[model samples]
Target: MKTKLICALTGVGLLLFTGCTNLAEKVLDEASVSGLTDKQAADGNIAPVYARLPDIFQHTTYFALQEISTDEAILPYRGGTDWGDNGIYLALHQHTSTSTDPNIRNTWLLLLQGISRSITAINTLPTINDPASKVYIAEARGMRAYYNMVMLDLFGIAFLKDDPQATSDILRGEAAANYIKAEMLAVEPDLLTTVGPGRLSKGALWGLLARLHLNYAVYRDRYADTFTHKPEDMDKVVEYCDKLINSGQYQLSKDYFPIFNSDNHSNPELIFAVDQRAELNGHNRLAYFSLSGDQFPIPAYVGANGTDGPAITPDFYQSWVSAYAGKDPTVDPRFYKQNLSIYSNPGDSCVAESAFNINRGILRGQQYGLIRVNGAFVKCPDGKYKVGKLFNTTRNKPTLPVNFTEKIDFTVAGSDYSTGYRVEKYEFSKKSVSGRNLGDADIVIVRLADIYLMRAEAKLRKSNDAAAALADVNTVRASRTVTTPPPALTSMNLDLLFRERGFEFYWEMLRRTDMIRFGKYEGTWTEKTNTDKQKRIFPIPQTAIDGASNLPGYLVQNPGY
Candidate 1:
């Protein structure tokens, strides 16, 4: 009876059943039965589905999920920070029992529901009447599949359903992977053949496929009693990576910064990205997290303290600094720009100024210009300044500078640190300031450099010492800082490749996945030392477990929940 109902509704083009508001109103009206053709219903429904993409790909959720899951980024709240509540989850998954604050849970449910709703709308589109409709549906499905992959990685289960109105069908382990694979395969042929460079193309399908298979070893064992990586799984990864690389559809961008700039949407390197409009979806967090005390002078946002800075983990900074020792300072500009101190300058340009190097301690008014012999504080011709102390004393008693470092701590205040190797992946503007909701940079989800690293890992796994794999990895590293090529490979393994990935793609949300693939997911860090079992998947949202009744056994919660 259920299957019969679905078939009949699909045949009659029950657009309202598919949950497309525009089409439902146009065809059936509020009565749910009115005078309208199936064709009109289908056309009207498609636009609303596209409109949902911006909301579905929202950053409020993705940024939290991405940073918390990786080592490259941490959510250390300083004073006067608004994004602190979510940051606490990033630091520790524990949340207050109060159900009123639903950001995390709401984000999870909305992404799942949004993806499901979008897929339902795409499935309802009338067949092939308009070429544009086909493209739109293809994009929608790809996005749906991508979102599903994220869910599987983070939650270890997906809400599987054939019909739009059906209840959520939870699938775990291999069952989940198989379902995701089937969806990708079903949509592969319909996607655009060549979607320019950065946009989603059939080639991008191969990239996503590579990602799925590369992590198959983990996904397949996420909810199982024991975990093991099969040789065949590695073969599948190599297969998809080869398709993406050999297809000649994409290439690494010459300049790494261009990949993250506001003008980066059309860059050839990006395989897929969530488009962020300045006025609509622009991220103020980057500026909010990275702005130093000087740029955001105190008594403005906070009473005596100024801007709270985002602090990089001490270990992460050491790793980069060690890698670049004795090498040309200009070798990889990204290392310095994305992961170094901001300098103090009185001029307008930030990057062009000399960096402010000071002791890593609290800055007070006495220390402002105490040791300078020339009486002129070493100010950069450019406006860049080291993110240290925020001086907020009035000119009458300017000598008594209050130590505003408390504003940068994670617990007391909500201030996000923009100090100590701040991320410069996206270009920072002089006009942009923290506390002001303004930024116009597009975030990169999948880029060509990532593909090269993926291909390298796959090839190393398949054929240990393959020169082609080594060359592919080296090509990407070479592009950063424009230095001598990396050493030729005599031997290769997942560990070496994973470390390379860590260095190549830090804070881009691939850290946790990379860690899992290399068997480092459960390794201890400053605050977390989760076991392998806990590492595979996050505890099912406590709310979900409490909500389920009928399928108590069917929905066995992941261990350690």
Candidate 2:
């Protein structure tokens, strides 16, 4: 008798099970088997797949990959020292880990499992006659394609199976790209035509295609050690981007914060976002990572409020301040919120006052004060380096001191000094904060602002003069803060455009791709310097290499592995 593995899909009555005697084989089979008319079959397959999304969404995997790939620095912690292990795999080239690190391997397996199950559902859903069901199935396919793209980007390979019941075979190089493109195109027609903003639409599918094709030069020849965008590929990028931008269904958000707000799932600026429900799968740790250390004002942190930490690096902060110099610092809220001190002036009645007083010689033990103001070093009244100000609003009169040991409770609303520039992207409801839940900010995968930038880059690559491209870029810039536009396209070059992109999309998860596209991926940094070979792809996970001994030469590890 065959053993039956039962699975359940809660909230959406779907159960799925597979008949296999071997538990490992059965779990793998159940993970990819989904053709249930009732809850039983659906739950068997769908639940396991859904279970992997939260794991993929974990900070160690998705968040870490996104941050390390970009210019952002990883927070120092154990098990993160070896660039080869995690940092270098992201910073340098494609990497495979043999270490018994569960975080790394679990991330890899979970992402692949997610793709496997999602594809299985997409391939098996023809039996379900409902159009709405088909649309959701298409969404699963699109998401699977997305996961494949990340795998292809990071690992330089993907698991492709033609038959749902067949053991997956890893495809590398151009073969992987071809498979992904075919899958995305197959599901394009079935996706929802007119979903609200931030939801997946046909346009986003094309955008994802554009993204994949834009990197074709790298994927087509991973071990070549040198890459340049082919003209034909650039044409395809232009073609797809034009279709999405001219689709007339999406537009840039008037304000930047709304794009990342908890209520921004339907914002018009978003093309696609990973839905993060604080109640269901709350792991938006970007807020916590980006907050300043002293910003913890909640009663739990001994401060009047929650812990506010994660300041912009001095170098990165200077880049933004330089870009919008001479403009009202308060105008573009994105700049202020992302770069400025969180605290307001002492006399100002703003609910969250500045924690550090620049005038007095008070420095909070936790907060790092402004080391430089308008390009000059800040000094205290006592002629010493004024690190930052600590504010005590709980007292009848707000007190400013270099260092204070007074303990204050943050139970009351005004009692907590919500001072300091914490990331304003994630909305902090009283419930979300007090409950210690992940912020429900939509993880925008693609946005209209990105389209503008892509078009600008493509046009710049084609026509040396990017006046039109600059106009498109400036349109997004204008929305951030009220400012007179810069001189009309006097100079538009790759460096300027690249820097603009860095400033605009700092932690939005496209930094590594953007850097590679502009030929800066292998350049040296303060902490990392990668070789040209490292620029092409990451090494296959050592486990994958160890598992597939039969497939000799078929699965060669990336160079330097």
Candidate 3:
């Protein structure tokens, strides 16, 4: 028998977990597992914890907080109407976000729910007598640590709790970092190496360890002008990265796009990711969010269209242009991948017999997608789709060509619908023929390329062998096996490594942390000008603070909020 968790959602859309500690206890309605075996019960108890990842990492929540806060991406109000969201995104990009901001509040709630779920699993899984129960318990602990790591990174505090009914011991800074590290270390041995990237595995644990150690200094002193990367932490980063590299369980993806393709669950490069198969309520927002409103990837269902959301900053795009010198950024395999050739010629139209595909990577100038004819997709004679140059379809800008400009001028009146260069790195899922909700792509949390780069950063910071670090970066650069791969760097430094990270991992929601680590988070880009160090971590949601107000110092807001 499989145990089922039926959670009651409150009026405010928060999960009212029943019999749970540290919050309002409405209690979760759980199905009894009286006749279930220990292994079955253990598996069932941990499922909901894993299920919380999709919502926590959604585009409008954590992804918005991470990417919109950085220079890599921006979400301006389109035509003073769409995505206005009462200037929540504008505040996020401008680094003036508050505790009441929806994104912050939603992220905090989801992350805490994930932690709570993990704690619930940890509490229940131990009672089972089977040996698998121990492993499940270890997984629960590891997951709790991962959630806390995100919590600490975002709000500068990690809620540590063993019992569901007890108050959480809020650890900040070094204490939080140490607790996360210790949890992963303690559970590392029990984690299975052969498990898939979606679960808590030895490889995932190692990757998490490397990430924790690499960013350990940032956690130690988040607002410091320059982080003091301790030699020991650097050693740990290198060690874990090396372990991952030598393990041979993962490899660098030769084709960069497949790493984020809808059917990427078995991709070896993924050490850990959110398993977002089409069957689940996964979202294709990452692909759809940054596209032009006129650009519709799916043809079968005319409803499946882009939201014309965020786009890459010109400063970020210029970084790629500068890195390549005279050569166009598109020449680099990682920069762009052209999948559709319908509009290759000026006055040409091609029949997309199977799937109406679009180009991937940083899109600039004119865009192309399915054209609409009286509220329906224009189709060829044979019932195939005909592609054409895209025009603005939303915000009453139908005649405007969907030409993405480099510079965005957002003002009190409005911003252009197609201002910033859009990024379409993740492929539009074939499964999402009808709408944007059903995305199958596993949201990549950790991959081998990141590991290589982490190792390189660790080695460089340690000042042991700059040559080895350069080699590692070159190794990653060489992974792009295009007609002419990105030229290997002649030399490597922190600046170059930082740029390389942007080239490899842009629009993947890692930019904010990267910018902070590189000490460029305070630098101005486009509309963002604020440089206050306290803005490093987002303010604790006012609701969270207020809810715990009775406890006095329980949920303190981050400084400089």
Candidate 4:
């Protein structure tokens, strides 16, 4: 049975379904809407557009394309068998993905759903005479522009449609960029400023515009030998960034971990985020994705363990070492935060505690957590709990201690369960007691630190002002209030600023575009040695191409595949 939804307009109501990935092209049957109030109509139409976000931003979908494909993260086939998934993940990291790759195809479908849902809301919201519907319509337009921006970034093409059953107008290069920019500009005045980061407020639109302009050079000419950041584009980036910076609505977070905590709804740094409040359509896959199989974060449920997923690449870890002049990267508050108190003493063998606390940041070396015996957690003599060094529970090597190593060889012998250092940035939600599904953390889309970095990059590229760029970089560093926040940099350059961004937003999924903009996408790192420029933008999924085959030249695959 399909889940049907009523897209309530004034008199005519369209029957839509949850499984329709491309709602824009679907011809709907007309149904009469009886007694829906303005609030009910707003809720029915606008909420689905926002609901599509959690699926789009899932770890196996967009995060895989954004983070795992770059040097920031990698998911090797554990024990030469697990996570192989027909080599899809390996293909992505190696720049060998095809149109049939499920991750790529799924990402395309979900992004289209976002655009489709936004289109549904945009077309229906105007019929309501309530003043709030106008704001909802503007938000829908902003969301549509945002989804198109991501589409343009990944596939080098965006589909625009105003009517429900109209054929989408395919756009690319300057035409697509200009269309998205124009839509945002037209809806700017109608967007509200007071709405929280979950919705597209005026500030969030400004942030999106800043992001679109910051990467404007790449979107304009994705395959250039070297991207040229025009002065006007850089100026636009700076102007929009300054609006969010001076708006007095947001601030840099003092403690970096709280910004990703489950209770971070009131965190002051978020400019735009997907609201996972009350575990509404929430997921714990991100928190559980990169953890070791034996290192469970939720103690109450033995089944709530990790699946031995992706880990941080050593090449990315070297960036932090190079930035801090060979000092321990833990000195930088952004790199690590020690929350587990049992490890206060290095030699403490057994602690009688049951709290499920784990340290954050790049988890390397020996890992310690609760031990299980006979399908139950081991308890101390005092009836609390016993902590022991973790071991490989899923793989055949039960005797091997769970010591995460820095060097991963991507071979049968080397790429075991504990090859690369895992990332535990997002806090595991305490609400996930029996399983790793319920999470409440609002995933950040845009924040103030990114704004500052955009402004700094614009300053460097626009006018070669090193001093001004240095000030902006240091402002972000000093805001991390720790025992010693990452010490202020006395100097700054393009390379230094790029490294700074990696430190600040490691698992936040901004690395792929950052690498391309800095002209480092072709550089070799670890298992990836391909220097093909065609791999910059992904190939359009074959399903999408077939879906639009009725209209000639409606959807064309990218140049590579």
- TM-scores for the candidates: 0.73, 0.72, 0.93, 0.94
Instruction: Report the error of model 3 at residue 94, Å.
Output: 0.9
Which of the two candidates, 2 or 4, achieves a greater TM-score against the reference?
A: 4
lDDT of each: 0.53, 0.54, 0.82, 0.82
Q: Could you tell me the TM-score of candidate 4?
A: 0.94
Per-residue accuracy of model 4 over 1-561 as CA lDDT, tens digit each: 124433312121111111234333322233434466777677677787888788778888888999988999888888888899999989899889998898888788777778878988898988877768989999998899999999899989877788877656778998999999999999999999988989999999999999898898998898899899999999999999999999999999988888999888789899899898888875547888888888867667777777778888889989888877768988899888776655676545455444557788888888888787667888766776677788886565678999989977578755788898889888777776645666788888999999999999999999999999999999998998745788889988999988999999999978998999999888898789999999998988776665555556656789989
Q: In candidate 1, what are the lDDT values of residues 191-248, reduced to their tens digit?
A: 8866653345787777788888887877877644534656676677677777776776
- 1-561, model 3: which lDDT tens digit per residue? 333444433222223311122333223334556666777777778787788788777889889989999888888888777898998998999999887897788788878888878888888877778778878888889999999999898889887788776667889999999999998999988989887988889999999999999999999999898999999999999899999999988999888888998889998899999988854855547878988778878776777777878988888999998988898997788888887775466444656647557889888898887888678887777676778878876556678899988887476432678788988887777776555766788888999999999999999998857799899999988887744678888998999899999999988878888888889989998789999999999998777666665567656778887
Residue runs of model 3 more than 4 Å from their true location after superposition: 1-31, 35-37, 129-131, 346-348, 412-414
Q: Distance (Å) between predicted and true CA of 202, model 3?
A: 0.7
Tens digits of per-residue lDDT, candidate 2, 104-131, equal: 4556666666676776766655554554
lDDT of 3 at 368: 81
TM match of model 1 to true structure = 0.73
Model 4, global lDDT: 0.82
In what order do the candidates fall by TM-score, top score first?
4, 3, 1, 2
Minimal lDDT window, size 10, model 2: 10-19
Once fitted onto the true fold, the runs of candidate 4 whose alpha carbons sit more than 4 angstroms away are 1-33, 346-355, 433-435
Please identify which of the two predictions, 1 or 4, would achieve the higher TM-score against the true structure.
4
Error of 3 at 8 (Å): 11
